[model samples]
Target: MEPAGRFITFEGIDGAGKSSHIDTLAAAFRRLGETVTVTREPGGTPLAEKIRALLLNDAMDALTESLLVFAGRRDHLRCVIEPALARGEVVLCDRFTDATFAYQGGGRGFDAKVLSILERITQSGIALEPEKMRDPDLTIWFDLPPEMAAARLADARAPDRFESQPAEFFGRVRQGYAERASAAPQRFVRLDAGQPRDAVWSQLTGSLVQRGWLQAGTSDVGASAS
Candidate 1:
């Protein structure tokens, strides 16, 4: 039987350069003869993508937003993430529950306890064990100052509801991510996003190598996977 696959997630506030590097990591896995499945939270399955649209465009209350995201997460897990992992294909997710905690719980002042409960329910099904919930084996958090992240977003595409929030809101979101990384240091690797693109890529690939996910001297064999 094939070995179980690794689930690696990329997370950070909007404009933190996560989207810029997720595919690079995936291509590295592919070059190593690993089947890579690149996907994202709030969307993966068709139904979940619809939910993603609603979540990004609508201005709903915090609880409502949380519920909607969890609902999408359920569909994503059942339809995409679980099956890919079962097949021993490396799953590279752009974002996951961490974003929900950062945005809704931290930025919107929603209750973390409540989010935790929902997390367990959505990822673990009927089980109440927090440990049973699906979590990334490794989460690459692109840590950047909120101001710099905002500046990056300024030149990017039109802002979504969350992206349109004030700088103070992003500050709280960054704090939320910091808390998560502190709480689960083993699963998270925080990288400075302010560095040059090549430096950021080095940090990412180096972390994967250190964790035994990649070989010591594998060269980039394909074009940019961005």
Candidate 2:
């Protein structure tokens, strides 16, 4: 079936201020009569959420961590993501394989080759032909300095495993995300997270509207986009 839905993902390190914008974007799409399914990685499905708990709190080797999240990803795909797309609903995922690559491969210094192989095996087909690997149509990356990100999280809720990583590790993860964005420039939009909150939202919403996913006036914020 031709998937009519759009798959967009919001990504960034902890405290890049990505979490606050997703639902608001979903609402904008809904205003345009689009059905938007907002979900998150390593935790979209029940089983995936179980895996998320382990990955977040437990200490394990990087390889083990990668395997668990991929397993969760597979389930999340089959159970939640794919179905929503099949029904023509926009999927707004908080994170996906990129996060795994960032946290495990980049942060933990795991083998990227292994992550690539796992990604191929696990995500070969979902909303597309069986031979094609599915990817988000658009990825909005809030690029923030690791130091500033750490500062944002200072008094926030307690961090999970990845969130608690040192500045050096986050620096690596940021680079990892940069590498991914570089590899797929068309699919990625990098936002300077240091900008004022209004500016960040302007960029984020403008991205969607600019892509023609939403009408010109789609974003009350991105109306500035026109």
Candidate 2 residues lying further than 4 Å off, grouped into runs, are 221-226
Best by TM-score: 2
**lDDT agreement with native, every candidate:** 0.87, 0.87
What would the TM-score be for candidate 2 when compared with the true structure?
0.95
| Deviation from truth (RMSD, Å), model 1 | 2.6
Give me the overall lDDT of model 2. Answer: 0.87
lDDT of 2 by residue, 1-226 (tens): 6677888888899999988888778878887788989999879988999999999999999999999999999999889888898899999999998888888888889999999999998998766788888788889999999999999999999999888989999999999999999988999999998887768887887777777777765546433332
Q: Provide TM-scores for the models.
A: 0.93, 0.95
Clashing pairs in 1: none
RMSD for each of the candidates: 2.6, 2.5
